[model samples]
Every structure is written in structure tokens, then in C-alpha cells.
Target: MDYKSYPVVENIFGISGLNANLANILMITVCSAIVLLIGVLSARAIQMKPTGMQNVFEWLIDFVKGIINNTMDWKTGERFLGLGLTIFLYILIANLSKLPFVITTEPGHVVWWKAPTDDPLITLTLAAIIIVLTHFYGIKIKGFGGYGKDYFKPVPFLFPLKVIEEFANTLTLGMRLFGNIYAKGILMALLVSLGVSGFFGFFAAALPTIAWQAFSLFIGAIQAFIFLMLTMVYMAHKVADDH
Candidate 1:
């Protein structure tokens, strides 16, 4: 099947190309809204003995804390507990949200929503943000001059290599997510094409699609965890005194 990207803002702004990844933007917005709503609702009624939404949210927070503690000391990592929690939950939601087949009015054009992580722009933007924050925190903790001197530690010639390493990390972190999620999208599209080809093809692809969906959920969760873990590692490397 031919592919055509949708631009949710195209009509309003008449922009395309990088601006055309609007569906991913919309999905990210939707996921953010849902996450915020869940947080609000869960916190609306707090009890000494937590249950249901409160319990789940607390558990999630502790789980994220565990992840942070694994990478950094509790004192330093606790400050980032919320950030880690938000990234993990937001990415997890974004990843699995694409599993449902969208109803579309036209072929090629994306439906109202798509997985934000499936878009490199979205993933790379997130990766860049994470790296930027790492630099910020490094400076905040170690002073601007201290953080700057890190690039040339043990030798003055390693500055360029260090810069290249940061760029590579950002590219790899983002592309890894986009590649996996995009492959899942392609698999879904192929299965859909198969289902539309003939009665026999429909039967042949139906079960496989369902099976793949289950497997994709694992992939999605793992990617989210990997992203979260890497983010923590990058942050730790920047802020830690060990250099």
C-alpha cells in the first residue's frame, strides 16, 4: 500500500515535510493529556491506606524510584524521580496506544492518531531534550566551568571526540526507538493489506496480526524501559563527580 503522511496543521499553516509529522504530535498531546488526567484523578483523593488509582500511582512512583536508584544515589536521583516517572509512563502509553487500528476516511493519510515514538522527529527531539537536561544538571551540580572542563579531562584533545559522542548518543537513542516502532507499524500495515486482498488472505493474516500485537506490546514496553534506563545513565554520567 502507498503511504502518505497526514498533517493535522497543514490546512491551517500550509507547511509540510518536517512539519507534516503532526499525527505524532497529536498522539503525544493525547498521551500527555491522558497521563495528566490519570495523575490528577489518582491524587484527588489520597488516603493513609491507599487503594485503586492511588495505589497504582504510588507503586509506579516507587518503581520509577527503583530505576533511578539503580543508576544514581538516592539523594541525587530523588530529585529526578518525577522526570523519570513521567518519561517512562508517557513513553509506555505512547508505545501501546498505536496497537488499536484507527478508522480512516482515506487510504495513505494517517488516521487521527499515530504512535509518536514511531516518528524520528519526536524521538530525536525527546532525546535531544534529555541530553540538554543532562548538561544543565551537570552544570547545576558541578558549576559551569567544572562541567566545561569535563570535555578535556586527562587531555585537551578529547573535546571534539566528547562532542561527537554526545551527538552519537542522541542519534542512536532516538533512531533505536523510531526503527523498532516504525517496523511495528509496517508489520501492521502489511497485515492489513493481506486482510484486504482476499478471503483466504484475511484468514491467514488475522491470527498472525493478533499474535504480533501481543509481541509488539512487549517490544513497546522494553523500548520504553530502555529509553528510561539510558536517560538515567546519561544523566548520571553528567552529574556524577567520578567523571
Candidate 2:
């Protein structure tokens, strides 16, 4: 398939020629709703002996808590448990959103469904949000003067490098996720195309496609964990005095 044939729904507004990716907007909304629904359903009933959704939810909470404890003292990290869990769930769902199937429209082959993380814009936006929140918490926990002075700590010359590091962190965090998900998306698309080619091609691609999907699910979970870990690490750097 020609890459140029990939359809994107965009609308230009105002004289600046700015456009919005309608497909990404839709997918983000859907993913957010799914995450919210899970949270609601999982917490609807509380029991001493957890089962089903509650058990899964408790496991996830414990996992996030472990990540926070590893990065910073629990006293400081306890506040971010909700943030960490939400990020993990949202990203995991977004990463796996396109795995079950691919949807495209005829006449133009416009992609109608895909993982939100497959787009650099979405991933980068997430990175920016996390980075900004770190700054917010840093200033909140440490006074503005203290937060500003951390850049020049130990020596004054490191300030420039510290400034640059923030930008690097955001770029790397976002690109790392986008690269992994986008590559997976491309390979899945290829396998799907092969499966549709003919009977022989379908048979040849079926097993590999299924196997790749299972691996993709693992990759998606790992990526979510990595993202959550890094977020807490960065948060600790900002909010913890020992860092």
C-alpha cells in the first residue's frame, strides 16, 4: 500500500491554516472513556476477598505503588498513586487499541481506526503534560526560588546543560513510545494486507500475525510500565529533596 494513500481527516480553521486530526481526537476520547469505565466498574463493589475486576484493579494499584516506592519514599510518592495508575491504564489501552483489527475506508483507503500512541503528536502531548506537571509539583513542594536554584546546584556552569536535559527528556520519552507503537502498527498493517491478498497468503500470514499480536500485547504493557516508571522518576526528581 502506498503510504501517501493513508487517509487523515483534517479541518483547517482560521487564517493560520491550523488543522486538527479528527481521527486522533476520536480515538483519544474513546480510550479515555474506556479507562474511566474500567475504573468505575472495578471500584463499584468493595470486598475483603477481591475477585474479578476488583482483583485486577487492586493488582494494578499495588504495581503502581511499587513503582512509586522504588523511585521515592512512599510518604512523598503516595500522592501520585492515582496519576501513575491513570497514565498506565490509559497508555496501555491506547497501545492495544488497534491490535484486534484495522479499519479503513474504501475509495481512498483512509485509516479510520488506530492506536493513539501511533501518532507522534499524541505521544508528545502526553510527554509535555507529564513534564509540565512535574514542574508544577516541584514549584508546589519547593518554593519557586528553591526549584529555580536546583538547576545551578553543585556548580553554576551546569545550568545550561540542565535546561537542555529537560528538552531532551521530553523528546526521548515521546519518541520512544511513538517509534515502538508506530513500528508495530506498520508490521500489523503489512500482515493484514498479506492476509487479504489470497487464500494462500492468508494461510501463510495467519499464524505469524497471531503470534506477532501476542508479542505486541506484551510490548504494549512493557511500554506502559516504562512510561509510568519514568514519570515517577521525573516526579521524584522535582518533588523529593533527596533527589
Candidate 3:
């Protein structure tokens, strides 16, 4: 798997060396637009009795509510419903996008799309955003003094350890998602390479590719749920009175 970076425009205008993966960024943007569209369509016309897209959206909202409610009370959790819903929908769409057929000349050179979550920069940025938001809320709920005091909890000796834990959480959260999705992409690339060998190789690759894609779908859903659940849990730790 070629893990090398693809320049955003190879060169923007006349200048060179603007580091960006435009393909991944575009995929993320497209996924975000799709999620937004679905949200709008779902609520375009509210029915006296919900049906179709409305029902599906309602169910998903309820499911996200449950994640928040599990970690904290509905009162506090409901405040973050938008974040939870957006993360789940966007990640799900991005993850599954790779499953569709791609007419590419080579593996890993998929032009139009790649899973956004598979990119470490995207995943880490998301993790940092969630972590930073939690800190902001912590400061809001607990005074600055109260929030700072958390690092010295149990014993003053553990202050450094507690501080380091924050960094650890950010890295683990981002890398876990990136590693899983990236591995799936790499596996798909490998399968594609095998299929290109010859006619026999193509048939041999078919079943395994289908199986792995199915399993990758399951992993994607589970990862999305895990990310949402972890976000809520982190928020709970920051906002709950007991913490």
C-alpha cells in the first residue's frame, strides 16, 4: 500500500508544495454534504405521523440519545445530540463509500473517493476537536480552578500522569479509527492487486473481497458507535458533578 501523501493540487496556481490530500478532503466534504442533505430531506415536511426517512432519522436520533444518556443524564447529553448525530452519519457514509466499484488504473489511486476516517490527519483532527470541546465544557461547568484541580486528583503526585493521560486519549482515539479503516483500505488494495494477476486470480479474489467488504461494513458501524460512545463518555467525565 502506498502510504505516501498526494498533493492537494500538485501545485496551487503557480506555487508548489502546498501539502494537502485533496482527494481525502473532497471525500470528507462530499460525505458531509450528503449527511446534511439527508438531514434536510428527513425534516423537510414533518408529518402528523412519521414515516419513511422521517422514521429512520428519528430512530437514529433516539439511538444517539441513548449513547449520551448512558454516559450522562439526558439533560446534559441532549446538548450534544448534534455532534453525535453528525459524527455517526458522516463516518458511516465515508467508510462505506469505498465498497462501491471504483474504476481505477492502480490500487490506492482511487481518484474520486477514499474513506476520510482512514486518513490520520482527518481522524486526529476530529479527536483533537472533541477533546478540546470537552475541555471547554469542563471549564464552563466547573470553574477554571475546578477544572485544573482534576489533574491533581487522588494525589498531587499523579498530576503529571493525569496531564499525560489527556494526550494519550487523543492519540489513541484518533489512531484507533485511522488504523482500522486504513487497514481495510490496504486490504482492499491487496485484493485488487491479486485480481489483476490474471483471469484465474480475478475469480479467486471475488469471494474474499466480498467477504472482507461485508466485514469492513460491520467494523465501520461499530467504530462509529464506539467513537460516539467515547465522545459522550469523555463529555460525561468533564461535565458530570461526580467527576
lDDT against the true structure, each candidate: 0.83, 0.88, 0.80
Error of 2 at 122 (Å): 0.5
In candidate 3, what are the lDDT values of residues 1-243, reduced to their tens digit? 232322212111223766666666677788989999999999999897999999999999999988888898887777799999998998788777775344232433445566788678889999999999999998998889988888777799998887898898899889998898888887887786677667998899988988888898898998898888888888888887764
Q: What are the models' TM-scores?
A: 0.88, 0.92, 0.88
lDDT-superior candidate, 1 or 3: 1
Residue-level lDDT tens digits of model 1 in 87-135: 9888988899885455444534435567888778889999999999999
Would you list the clashing residue pairs of candidate 2?
Answer: none
Query: Model 1's lDDT to the true fold?
Result: 0.83
TM-score of 2: 0.92
Candidates arranged by lDDT, highest first: 2, 1, 3
| Best candidate, lDDT | 2
How many backbone clashes does every candidate have? 0, 0, 0
The C-alpha local distance difference test score for the whole of candidate 3 amounts to: 0.80
Q: Candidate 2 deviates by what RMSD?
A: 2.4
What TM-score should be assigned to candidate 3? 0.88
In model 3, which runs have C-alpha deviations exceeding 4 angstroms? 1-17, 100-112
